[model samples]
Target chain A: MKYDCDACGPELGAYLLGESSDETRREVDAHLAACTACRDELERERALRTALGDLPTATCPGAVTARILAVVDAEYAATRRRNRRLRGVGLAGGLLAATLAAVLFLRPGAALRGASAEHYTPEQVATARHELIQTLTLTARVLDQAGRSTLVDVFNDQLPSAVEGSLRPLDDPTRGG
Target chain B: MTNETFHELLATHRDRVFTQALFSLRERRDAEDVTQEAFLRLWRQGDHLPADRVAPWLAHVTRNLCIDQTRRRSAARRHLGVADADAVDGLVAAAGGPDDPFAGLDLDDRQRRLLDALQTLPAETRTVMLMHYGDGTKLADIADAMGKSLAAVKVQVHRARQRLRLVLGTADGVSEQRGSA
Candidate 1:
């Protein structure tokens, strides 16, 4: 709709603010071309807007930037540390899960005393038992060095003498070697 | 965002945010506080906020915070029964330094008159004017932040313009009459 001066009077604000729709702007432009009063009002609005825009901007103080950066860096570092700790825990959990699977699948009667034993050749059973015993021996030595002997005691009762000899150093507190 | 990108954002947009808050609040300390708070908010959001939109986002947030601060201040003034003149004094005290809007302006008589007249506008009206004229924020954005209709924000700006014009025009006409006499 082509807004005349009367209709465009209130709409002048929206037009000057660039908030008016294209149709309304076109109408206002057409009206402004003919209406001196409206043109003068528009001029004043433009002048005021220009002056306000030209007003000097306030600068952010150096101190504030320093302060904000410090806080942001600290928070970012904390997030990184937490993520690293989570990754460590995930690695440890995966290793523990692998150890549990080895123990459950290769126990003395678990694979050798049933119809399941026929599925394996004699050579395969011998290799599997040998690897399982080696893994348990390494685990016992690690626990002994760490001074956590509760699980080591259980391993000592079940392991063969060949594996048990390697664990004797872990029981001697004065033996650094 | 990485620290490098955030530092760039701070350098590019801090003045814009500070200017908006300063003009809207008319108090240097409050404006500084608002600017710091807005940037702190930016830091909290971190890489989640897109880089290109940072300027307008900061402007919008700073304006809203200034408006809220203004409302709280006005409420306190009302509860304390502070008069208009005293509020002006409080403004000076709150300013406390070289945060004058007219600073470094080579203003003519009419421009000076307009600036003086601006100081007389009500807080909400002046805020609309500042956001629209000073900060160059869109009226639709101002309307959204002020929680007013677009029409209402426009009307407020228009009225502010008319008020400044009346004050400045009358002064000009009187001076011309004296000159002619």
Candidate 2:
């Protein structure tokens, strides 16, 4: 191994640390035998590594860790509160949606009577129609205010179509208004 | 991640993270700040991080935060027209606090020289040296954690060792001998 100091300098650290490959270690070993400078350099590196290992560990202050945990605890609490609020809102929305569905679908003479408009006078039909519209408007507003757009969408698109389908026979010209 | 798991991670890694930050930034306050920020980030992203990779992930984050703080300090120094000499003096002064790991320690002359030289190296090189030697982290693990190749990590550690030797006067005779040869 004709390794000069310049050529062997880089390998010495790895060689000292035993990070060098077996073949590289042999080459460095052979080089060190012939190279006094390289051996001294290796010794210096060994000393540095030993000093580094001796360097005291710096522990985080108890107060600092406490402060960090305090922040994390506060954050976790706030998140839990937020999740609770959202769950409450979701439950309220679900109940409101179910109530609306029952009012629209389950009331007698509401959806079961195919010709509901024909069964009542013009005034009765107008009053019933106004009430249905008011109920839908209120439900939509509540869902919208709750920031539950999916429920609002159900009210806006599907619920209206359902009401219209139930009253579809009312659109017949042969049936009096 | 559960709160209990996060707390366990903090308990396990806080010292290592704090030590790394202290070494890289050379300031207790900045190191604490970086350590807190790193942990906060870990907490926020804990669910997304794999359990096996937490150590490396935390190490990488702590190193990045330290680097960011170092750059900010350099920019502030440049803005204020503070010379590097004054900044070095500030670092020395900062290390005199009660919590300083080196304070009142019975370090030998060579160890003292090496410590001083460690501060002179670049942040990346210093970090590699400290991680490899101080933390007893394997070079291959450091390479994987730092997203660097094994060869690159070895080079950084080698360069740091060489720089420390030069700073400590151990390399002077060797250099002269080689020069004459």
Candidate 3:
């Protein structure tokens, strides 16, 4: 007979654990009597179990509970904060985009307005200038100090005395055409 | 249960839980943490179970948590530079007290080598063996805590013991096992 190790297997497991019943005990003993291999195997297993069982149980670090709970709480708080910040960021981004879109659409005139209102077509600009020179003599004046200096130097270097004198009328604050 | 009763329950089982984690994870800090967490879960789930179920429930939850820690430790050991992270290895390497059964022996190296081999076992098998040997929990209790069928737990334990036999080699002077006929 290919020796019946079936019952012996669990018996050995129980024997190692000291939980073997009398029936398992008797059966395994009977097998051991007839089988030297099984007998030595049983002895070996029993010794191994005893050795391991005799070893002291290792103690976990003293502060393990507090540390684990602390880590858990920190992780929980971090998750909540991340969710809140994500919500706030999402709300802010949506509001900003909507505001920019509203500005562009509601005030197409502002977005589409030309460079300046005084800008005119080439012929219209020339005609207006000619009319101004012939009649009321409209002139552009530099109000700031740097602009005034630049205008003064440019006029002195680039224009004749009579033309410069003609430009003097436009310096009055009340002058317009 | 009343708050006082619940607090009493926690105080009563705290040591058992702590000791179990300590032995299973082989790290004191981790055991204490697992105990706290297990008890906290017990408190949170207090309404779900009756008072009598508390200890067994605590054992179950704590065992699971320790198993998780064991799995994490092993996985961590598999990564870079953590060879001794396994609890068994840590115990053998730094566990030099006279209290250690393996500390003084004719075959000290062999004992340590056996422990190191046991350390490399899969977490589930190691946990079963630890509960079986270290905590002295019965196969039935270990089976219940491990959520395994009694027969399956039996087989698992046998395998663990057989491997232990092979490693320790007739621990304490019986003889090496003869191959099965």
Candidate 3 chain B: worst-modelled 10 consecutive residues by lDDT: B172-181
Please tell me what DockQ candidate 2 reaches: 0.25
Scored against the true structure, residue B178 in model 3 reaches a CA lDDT of 35
Model 1: per-residue lDDT, tens digit, A1-177?
557766776677678767789988988999999998888777666666766666666676787778778887898887666665555444434544676586666455554656474587786588557656656655554444323223333334423343455445545664222
| DockQ-based CAPRI category assigned to the predicted complex of candidate 3 | incorrect
The true-versus-predicted C-alpha distance at residue B119 of model 1, in Å, is 4.0
Tens-digit lDDT track for model 3 on B1-181?
3344555776566766775565456565566667878876775564777765666567778878988877777677787456545565667667673243322234445445555657666657866775666556677776775677888988887777666656655442324423322
Which runs of model 2 end up more than 4 angstroms from their true locations? Answer: A1-48, A96-104, A108-177, B82-101, B104-108, B171-181
lDDT score, candidate 2, position A69 = 93
Per-candidate Cα RMSD to the true structure, in Å, reads 9.0, 9.1, 19.8
**TM-score for every candidate vs. truth?**
0.64, 0.66, 0.48
Across B149-174, the per-residue lDDT of candidate 1 in tens digits comes to 87777667777777766766645422
What number of clashing residue pairs does each candidate have, in the order they appear? 1, 0, 9
What is the lDDT for B109 in model 2? 59
Residue A119 of model 1, lDDT score: 81
Q: Evaluate all candidate structures by whole-model CA lDDT and list the values in order.
A: 0.67, 0.71, 0.58
